[model samples]
Target: MAGLPSTARVVIIGGGVVGTSSLYHLCKAGWTDCLLLEKNELTSGSTWHAAGNVPTFSSSWSLMNMQRYSTELYRGLAEAVDYPMNYHVTGSLRLAHTKERMQEFQRARGMGRYQGMDIDVVGLEEIKRRYPFIETHDLKGALYDPSDGDIDPAQLTQALAKG
Candidate 1:
């Protein structure tokens, strides 16, 4: 930091994980002079309420790519930044209520397949047996992505800062 200039060429707004991520990436990309402005404490904004569920079953390619990047970045954060980002891989279980919803999930799974994502359309029996905490009666089915899961924001922030 002492070798870099005092003023940064690029400025990032916000202080949440995303903003911190942008700052971290900028530094990693050789833009050490980049700056991030946070009006409040880190995770003071919408990020504090975030569920930290990183998924990869989006229909859009760009969004999916971003998810991919975030997922990978968080997964290898320990090696990349010398600190661990507490990411949970509990997987996501999206239950269905109607036939239409089942169709929608099928379409989503198809789209995920197109994007090379690991997604599957499961039946009510399967979901019920797996989770056992859900109400499947009168429902159609569900879409389960075993790789989807949550993350700890505080540890993630610390990890990024540690880098």
Candidate 2:
């Protein structure tokens, strides 16, 4: 913490993933005069227990785009930073046991299509093919998004902070 600046163009509150990410992006965009303040330790809040699921499938086009952007950003940041984010693009599957859930998935898939996301509603056989361990007997279908995955939120936040 030596040579701390007396003034910063941007003072971001919190040291969580979002706050650090904002600081990181601002720096990347050529704004080096920024400061991030955390009342407690970084990622000690909700980010610590987050599922870390970076699913791009959403009923809203805007949300889907934002998730997609975040996923891409995390992927690039993991490679660029010395610290590791443990990002895993293992994809995601949302199971639908009931007809109502199936319809919801279908609608979400439709929304994803407009957002340029490759999401699909797959039958039980396809689900079983992808995830053999899943118990697909009771499932009507599933929504599969190939780009969806996860990352270590704490590690990502650390990397962002380092940047």
Top of the candidates by TM-score: 2
Each candidate's root-mean-square deviation in Å? 3.1, 2.6
List TM-scores for all candidates, in order. Answer: 0.81, 0.82
User: CA lDDT, every prediction?
Assistant: 0.79, 0.86
The total of clashing pairs for model 2 equals 0
3-103 per-residue lDDT for model 2 (tens digits): 77889899998888899989998988999788888879999888888888888877677888899788778778866887877888888889899999999
lDDT (tens digit, per residue) of candidate 1 on 51-115:
88888766566787688677777888977778766688777878788888888788878877776
- Identify the candidate with maximal lDDT: 2
Give candidate 1 regions above 4 Å deviation.
1-7
As a whole number from 0 to 100, the lDDT of residue 138 in candidate 1 is: 74
What does the lDDT come to for candidate 1? 0.79
